[model samples]
Target: MKNTIILSILLLIFIFNTEAQKSAEVISIGEKVTFFSKTLNEERRIWIYVPDQTSFQKKIEKRYPVLYLLDGESQFYSTVGLVQQLSQANLNSILPEMIIVGIENTNRYRDLTPKVNSTPFITFLEKELFQYVDEKYRTAPYKLLVGHSLGGLLTIDILTNKPEMFNAYIAIDPSMWYADEQFLNQTISQLPKQKLTDRKLFVGIANSLPPNVTLKNVSKDKSSETRHIRSILKLGDFFSKQPNKGIQYKQNFYENENHNSAPLLTQYDGLRFVFDFYQSDLSEKDFQDSTSLIVTKLRNHYQKVSKGLGYSVAPEEEFINYIAYDALGKKHFSKAKSLFILNLENFPQSNKTHAAYADYLAATGDIANATEFYEKSLQIKDDKAVQQRLLTLTSKGMTLTESDLIQYVGQYVLDDYKITIVLELKDGKLISKVPGQADSEFVPVSKDVFTVKDKQGYNITFHKTNDTITGFTSVQPNGIFKATKKS
Candidate 1:
């Protein structure tokens, strides 16, 4: 009777659910890369998130920094999510776009332990994994490694022995209590000898104390669970007094979180702590204060960042255009021009950049040069927005009126094809209506040329011979079609 009642309830719930019929789509997070280790004589599958460049033109020349993640199967998705969210153009923009390489573990015990003396993992990483990623993807010289728990224990090993493997290291809630805390001793002794240079480290210490025991009093209560936190605190103490100014090190203690829950916040703080110079948040007053100096400040900022990253880092094109568009909106023509030109100099081949510069030129009363840029932009890539802008400038003094929209309001039929196109004038706009299709509004860019709004067909160019409108060419995605007015 209970099973029958439960089944009946489930059936009723399913019947009421509108979304029950929908099938879940499979999401491919990243591609799998197999790294064959010559030293260890083993094969390992690695998960890598390379930037999607199939739609981007000339992507072969682009390169990005790499963020190597340990314990990949457990943390790859979370790290990838953070990378996408923070590196977006309009969002946080705290970090540069990086290729996230997550190393999936086949066996955790042999590879990640310091006591087993499995120094072969270092050979696998420096030789096999690093080379595999660099050769397969467009990667920069700078690299960052993030690890947690057992992974963090391994991270400390590489930071001590193979310090040149990565530019920055993040270790979260490591099992420093392993084998009588020998790894803690290694960190203490090795850090003093290592020349830190530009290397950075961010340590995340989680609160795994017993209930009712505060951090201040946890040291006195020697329990088996508290041993891990105690070892991490000892390492933190050594990091605090490490007299190397060249090495950048910071420790964040999360009193609310435990060992497993600390990684989410740890990875976030670690990235921000390492790449503090990547964010370029400028207030309105910064641009308004001195129109001429804004662009200069931006250039100097990126220049300093490039020196630190050991590569020539250019400011993102979207960020520069964001500032430039803001300047243009505020009527600061000089600042707008300077910022836009600087972007064009940095990213001359970008279609959107060219279109932005063209808009600036047209606004500043430079029609001749604006046309030149619009043509250049169209040459690189033809966009309906750019095409409409170009036609607007070229078709000067020829404006479309409501009465003019009425002339094309009749049925159009193509002789070769059996398709019929109908245009109707509605509310001072010409809308196209076809059988089994949604209505699309035509926005007038010129007297006889129109671009349909809401991602419909392309430009509709009217054809006339001796001042008589005969037919129009409808630009479709497949190909162009001509239809003569029928009745």
Candidate 2:
């Protein structure tokens, strides 16, 4: 009687599920798009992830390299997350930001194996997929391909036969015993013929043998179950002994991990090796030694990276701008000048670069060049901040000479507010400091009038009696206050 009642309940629930499904809500995690491919006479679907518009900076368009992944349905989410975590999190930029394209397979055996003549799939990638993506998104010329298992076999095939398709290739635990070692023998024979300069390949080997079998004696015992591991071992040995074909190749053996649990770690290791030239380090002494030396090292480092990537890669404009402002604040004028000028050369079209250069000039009291770059920046983009700065500079009685600025350097105190402000001249610029607070810079806007740098709507004006400095008035958003000159 209990079983009969349970069956009746289940049958009623199933009958009513169709009606209940009408109100169901859809949960979308990410983007998936489809396009019909003429080469395969079928529709293809792919998952894509690109950096957010604000990932790098505001109003700056940046292009990134593409990483084409196989087995999209299973690998898409983890790969995208890994790329984001490595490139953007915790002040760590171990890898360059990239666009990830995961290709969803329609038929694994038909599309991923050379035995099934996967030429049409390759044709679809080259003729249809590449063109479609290039036309739709901002992509750098450099490309990387990653595959696992049978997909890994396909990856190796592409590296051997179509070396120019991608700049880097990662094969994770490939089934090398496919079709009686035909693919393996073909790869070994064709590898010597291909010129792999400026290319990189990373192969990951997983432990696929029985619990009792080990690397030392597994080779002697040839069983059908052990064929996969032996075949991968042979390919690894070939790579080790072969003459240098200009390809940067590496193979990693994961003894503790099995075939099913290797792709995650393998992908991480593979990317690091392929992009070994990308990350750069600097010592404290390097920054202290010479500013020019820092610039030279950066140039040389990117040059090496550019050669490896087969494209021109400039130092990021934001990095240069940050260090420039840092040097300017530290009174390292020469260092700041070099960094600012480098940005102007590398990113001539960027309004931020021009505006930043204008800020440096304004801080250093070069009114003419500052005015020129500020106008140039406005011409490119109508930024309200830049426009306000230009308006302030062009206003009458706003320009003040260094000699005129030197007169106002003195200690002052606001008795009513119980606040003390100290002013000093360093590198021909006025710096203001309050006890237990960070130092503030004062940029001259007019005779005896100044604006606090980087702080909006804050200004100070000085009063004089018989050409002698007396006191100053502070203007802020909240209210106006007065400070008397103490020294």
Q: Give the top-scoring candidate (TM-score).
A: 2
> Among all windows of ten consecutive residues in candidate 1, which has the lowest summed lDDT?
51-60
Expressed as tens digits, the lDDT of each residue in 1-487 for candidate 2 is: 9999999999999879977898787743357899999999999999988866216443236778899998988898888878878876664567887888999999888888875345788888888999988887788899999999999998998888889999999999998889999999999998889988888999999988887999888889789989998998888889999878788889898988889899988999999998888887766776665465788888888898788778888888888888888888887878888888889998999888999998888888876567667767877888999988876764522545668677888889986887888898877678999999899878766567766666544557789999998988877656788999886
TM-score of each: 0.69, 0.75
Model 1: per-residue Cα lDDT over 175-225, one tens digit each: 888888888898788778886789999999998888888778777878897
Clash pairs of candidate 1? Answer: none
- Off-target runs (Cα >4 Å) in candidate 1 are 1-25, 51-62, 115-118, 211-225, 286-290, 371-487
lDDT, model 2: 0.83
lDDT of 1: 0.81
After superposing all C-alphas onto the true structure, candidate 2 shows an RMSD in angstroms of 13.0
lDDT of 1 at 46: 91
